[model samples]
Target: MKFKSLLAKPFAAYIYSKIQKEMMHAVADQEAILQNQIKTGCKTVFGRGHRLDDVHTYEEYKQAVPLRDYEQLKPYIEKIKQGKHNILWKGQPLYFAKTSGTTSGIKYIPISKDSVNNHIDTARNALLCYMAETGKHDFADGKMIFLSGSPTLERIGGIPTGRLSGIVNHHVPRYLRTNQLPSIETNCIEDWETKLDQIVAETIGQNMTLISGIPPWVQMYFDRLQAKGGKKIRELFPDFSVLVHGGVNFEPYRPSLMDSIGGAVDTIETYPASEGFIAFQDSREHEGLLLNTNSGIFFEFVPAEEVFDENPTRLSLKEVKTGVNYALILSSNAGLWAYNIGDTVKFVSTEPYRLVVTGRVKHFISAFGEHVIAEEVEQSLMSVAGAEGLRVTEFTVAPRIQVAEGLPHHEWFVEFEEAPQDLSSFSLQVDRQLRKRNIYYDDLLRGNILAPLKLRVVRKNGFIDYMKSVGKLGGQNKVPRLSNDRLIAEELMRFLQ
Candidate 1:
């Protein structure tokens, strides 16, 4: 074994033991985090405005701080941006993570000094856990590539600001810096295609062992590398062993990625966002991610169906049940209180609080009163595609309510690496799977309220071109799996094959 890999083993074991102990006491850890946040929050401007001083218990905290999304909390954030102290947290934020907003033009999410470690340390823990569980740490001996945003920052209200990934880039440890690929200048390139080409040039001849990125972008990199070298990724980089991916469901892209690699590689899934690092795949044998309960964040779950109600039912870590879909809410040391992050999850194991991300709260299709989530659509397509030995490149679903002759239906825009010989049959199989998963959709079909979903073949690189056109080609941006309206579908019509 290489010296670095040999050295990592003992440290990995120690970190793994610590993680296990935290999981065993997940509920107690959450309670302690909640109390600490409350005690600190009582001294802030937001706390004073919301009457947080009288709050001593969970119930009182809930009553004191109603759930708020980014827009709802913007006023306080604005105060902090204007250089106010003790407005949200104890002092001015250390940085602002700038992300493209859905409704708001640009969002500046605060990252406080106390909570910044949550982002950096949790990522390290994930890799160590992998090494400890699988006893495969040789990847550290060679180069590691993270296809991420530029490590560039600008000042906003005198606070450093950039994308979350870019901010994390600045904190990569000294040991790993020696093995990290793609020079800083190359990463600083703004355009994705330019940066990707540069990354390929830099790493094509290097001993790349580990790659981390969202699956779609990583797939794009693989395609480009193959085109340039005329060899499978594994042949070009024989040491390549681990793929760390998140941001979207990996199943739909797995077939294409594996084909490009030409062999099996260990993969680790993570649950991370601008707000916090929530979970990571802790064991190869487990079915779901182990929640990060001991981190500087306290989690809450509201039943998915009641999320839009005036007052939804919020359940704590100890109260969550397995198999129920719930919208994730959190209160963190970053000064976000009872904040709904807009993502939904389903707990698979309450014993250790392992959960699977189901979908986004706003990224669903329910125009016909049949709520179809991202997970259902992804599983439907993956099941049918796998059964037929086909590979999909990219896909999205949008409700088609204005049909010319037939009843309204869901329209699936898909780009295929290998097109099915019988498109109609493939579509039927996928539609059947979706119906089997969602009874509301099945009922709508039975009652003739909606027609069976229609499949539209998108030309190769169609999704990529669409994203590029909108200036969201890379760096944490992903196409919504499904939407209630036809905005994306209407735009996709130009790319139809």
Candidate 2:
């Protein structure tokens, strides 16, 4: 492949035309941003102003800057609230993408022109790579369908700042852009119901091809599409090329989604955040997604083992190798310098820098000191389901310590698409699998630890509906994979009880 790429370099250049130059320019621009951040970041820290010495290299960038979260920058954010550009940017931010405030309620993530440009470039690179591989720029001469969030623009006083989706949606090139299906860009409004109505109306008789969004939301969208009286959307739009999803793991909702789609529609995983579109699926056949290093940021990784309880062990772009788990860190033009985004990934390959996301370091349960990761839990559940031939609808795991004057145990509340005949055995199987994978669970089995695994079956789709009713639909609003305290667990227990 390397030899072919080298030999085909001249021809590739001829074929790509200015694309190669644009890619190179993108890299140069990203590097310049990193350089400038290292300098300004120091000035921002000291309030003494920045100099050349303060900037340069990862070490200097680290030393000259103090780590800050969104809360720390609240004063500047307040300025934006008052319609002023105070700290982060030279002017008022283009607009804010309304993201769920994980621990803080609802907060708006400020989006700048540079950050938006980076996201655009990432999308272009992904599209170009696909075009180069397939040799067919257009898929079956049909349009793509993106099941996205409310694309209504944020107008403080009705001036049209543009919807988060529309910001990029409107910028799609006139040449490549299609007129086939409804886009979230123009369709997103205040009401989700009205948006869904328009989406259904627009794609009812059209040749819609691609579908993209968070998995659970996509499943709900498919349900709506099917509910609109279609046996198969394939029958409606035969050319549908693929389903693209990201923001959260799709494993939990895969069964229902796959069943709704009838089969796999060439699934593509994307790792995009308000920070930037960081990585994406390289091809149809590959398991590992390609990292976009040449996008608007310089990538760094901290060994996953170092991600919890201590300061992280950082790695440069040149130091990352295969098979090791690392927490992702980024230094981008959008004022995030060496920012730890809390996502953990495993290196699948090094040459082109491909990785498989393992789980979030913070998103785990250690109630019985089992230290169960989200990936491990997902894999174990899938394995158990495959073994039992059971179809699951929705499920959630809560760390519980059964203290009834007895030893404590971890409990999982599951909702299956079909109820099993031997519920006890199925529950036992899930418990045993956890015991095998988690040392703490094993200790509990041996009467060493205080807790063992327990399972409770719930009505179908109960958990999902509850999450939705609470407005925890997508984009940072998720039923947590693990909840240490009983806050979420207690709330969920309302329906279970």
Candidate 3:
């Protein structure tokens, strides 16, 4: 009834319809693009290297096209880097966004002119969703700050290319770009410390009213802001209205962020990845993040009932329904077709196509044969922190294999705002909760295959410092929360020692 009231307003229904219509157009366009590529791929396999990147027919593509990855696309990407417009697209690209995935190495993902157009469209849809929910569309009246990777467009090996953050800043409607202060200065790739300092300096007098980015780096920035002590955020930005975040779960890091903001600001969670813009916060309840099905992306779902494999069944947009957990697979205009990026999600319902992120398919710990997921770790930390009246600064779980000739056990490294009353008891409670949630862990417990869980109290910035030492402090890189027992045990030995 409440949702009906919210959707009944003429303005709300109009906006929603517009988004739906635009999304349909994107889907249609993407299908056409893929059809063309399939044709070109067919031609290439039949001894036609010169004719590649040209238009292809459906039959030509369907006959010979193979699933591609970053490695397979390397030579074509190099041609693009050489300023060869015809290699990847018919026109020159606006910029190349350097995206890193699953490793420390960087990827030069060319941002085609049409993809830039897609960014504008995506930005508009985000705004429209905001307006439909709150009935407010006046973004110009207030300042909005996007906490992005250093805005400096750094070169990979030799070519000067922007990261996704820098490319987005470079393409921001031209007007908003002028008023904004970039998190990174131009041509500076010195290091993280220098980069953070320059970013902090840029914020000194800016009246930024809205902020967006990964919550961890945003929290780090706010910590630095608090240390400065002279400028309170509320005083500096009186019109501050919202916080937008994406890329990871927010619950474990919420308390410190809430305290910094001083009050409840409008919160928006987005699912923007290198592949496509998947979803955004659509309602006040935070019940489900709405999918942007109109974007030139066709969605597929792999049910959680089975392990994802070479031949897992996929559900199309028409077939997905409510209350089923599924891994997401996407086909998009940017060249990924039915490619699985390994994020797991579940549909809250199908008609409106709302879904919630369940976890990462690849980011699980199977140490000592107990499969532990990121969602389990996040939920456990959030629940425990809330119940104990404790504010967690940052925490990570590392599964340890017993090296003393006994059963392996799980260990958690936690950093809190203050110490707890009973460290050992608190540790036991968290372990029990974790064991209850994870079926694999419960089985191990019953079999007496695992020892009791252990806890380690870490200093603030402990993980941050460790990441920095490994040269993976930020910028699309995240510390792994779960790993196989071998990797976890190795990491734990280093940290514990």
Candidate 4:
């Protein structure tokens, strides 16, 4: 038995048992965490201003701190950029993870020493939870490759700046880094096109037991391997047994990936954001992701149905009901207080606190009173494709505004790995499934508020080409699954044309 496995096995088992207990008593856990976060931040300017010192209970904390987004926090973040200390958190920040903005250029999210340690711990424990649930430790014995962003960080206000993946790269423990693929020189390459080529060259001959990355890029890596030598990935690396991916729903990519790998492998999904590492799939016996209740982040939820309200009611883990979509809000050791991350989730189970990501707050379309989300869109596509024997590669949907001549409708730009025999029928099938799922959409269709969901069969490699144009081709970056407006759709049309 390897030393790493020996250390990892017992650690994983303890976490697995602890998680089950924590989730069973989640209300107390959440309440204690909320108070602890407030107490910890009492020394910061934000805390003093919000009377964090007096906030002793979850209700009191809620009354003191108003929920905020990146825009609302921009002012404090700016002060921090000017070398401010004890602003949001209790100390000076050493790094800032640069994230793509929701509506604009860039966002600099502060990352402190305390939060970085929390990030590493939560990330490791997620995988450990899986190991504890299922006794599979063979993959840990050999090399592992994770497609991450370039580790060449730039300095912003004397603070290190780069993608969240880059931040995690620096902190991966010495034991694992020794067997990690892709040399430091290769990771430093800024351009993804050139970087991927280098990664393939470095990893193709390695005895890789595990591969980790966002699904599309991993597929791209597999594609390059096949194009180079017509052999399936399993043939090139026989030891490959695990593929861990996250950042997007996996169903759409499953068939393509399974085909590429040429066999069934253990797959794990994780939920890590620029804001914080959130959750991971814990067991093969169950499907939904286990929430990290003890991961230095206190989570709150607002019913997605109430997200647009001026004063939405905030609910803790104890109060959240299963099957209702709720927008995730967090207060973390990272110095964010009552921050809305904009992602929506529905609880699949409350006992072990397993949930499914529903969609983003900004990614939904509510025009014509029909609120359609990414989950609805993706599920509709998956159903139609499965029935029609088709494989879709990448897709995005946006509303086509009403004109003088006709009614507005949802337009889908889909790039397919296997195109349906009749494109028109496929589009209709997708439309039908969506209508079944979304009654508002169905009502609009019946009432003529929407003409029909439009579908355009995009050219091969169109999504990759579009992502390259935007300079976000790989590493935690993915094409926006849905947009409320025609900005992305129109741009994609222009680029593909």
- Best model number under TM-score: 1
Instruction: List the candidate 4 regions with Cα displacement exceeding 4 Å.
Output: 495-497
Which tens-of-lDDT digit does each residue in 1-497 have in candidate 1?
88889999999999999998888899999999999998898899998998888988888888889999999989998988888899889998888999887777898888899889999999999999999999998998999999899889998888899999999999999999999988999989999999999999999999999999999999999999999999999999999999999999888888889989998899999998889999999999989999999889999999998999998998889999999989999998888989898999999998788999999999999997898989999999999998888889999999888889989999999999878999999999999999999999999999999999999999989999999988899888999898888888899999988
lDDT at residue 151 of model 4 (Cα atoms): 84
Clashing pairs in 3: 23-294, 38-61, 39-61
Candidate 3: lDDT over CA atoms?
A: 0.64
Q: Compute each candidate's TM-score over C-alphas.
A: 0.99, 0.84, 0.82, 0.97
Candidate No. with top lDDT: 1
1 or 3, greater by lDDT = 1
Of the pair 2 and 3, which is ahead by TM-score?
A: 2
Tens-place lDDT per residue, model 4, 1-497, is: 78787888888889878877777776677777777778779989889999999988888888999999899888888888888889998777767999988664689888888788767887677678778877877678788888999888998877899988888899899989877889989998888889899889988888989899999999999999888757999998899998998899999999999989898888989988988888888778886898878777899999998888999999988788899999999998889999998899999998878899988998988877898989999999999898877898989999888666789888899988867778788889899999999999999999988888878878899999988877778887888788888888887995442
**Model 4 score (lDDT):** 0.86
User: What lDDT is reached at residue 57 by model 2?
Assistant: 64
Residue 371, model 2, lDDT = 72
Look at candidate 4 and tell me the lDDT of residue 146.
84
RMSD of each: 0.9, 5.2, 5.5, 1.5
TM-score of 2: 0.84
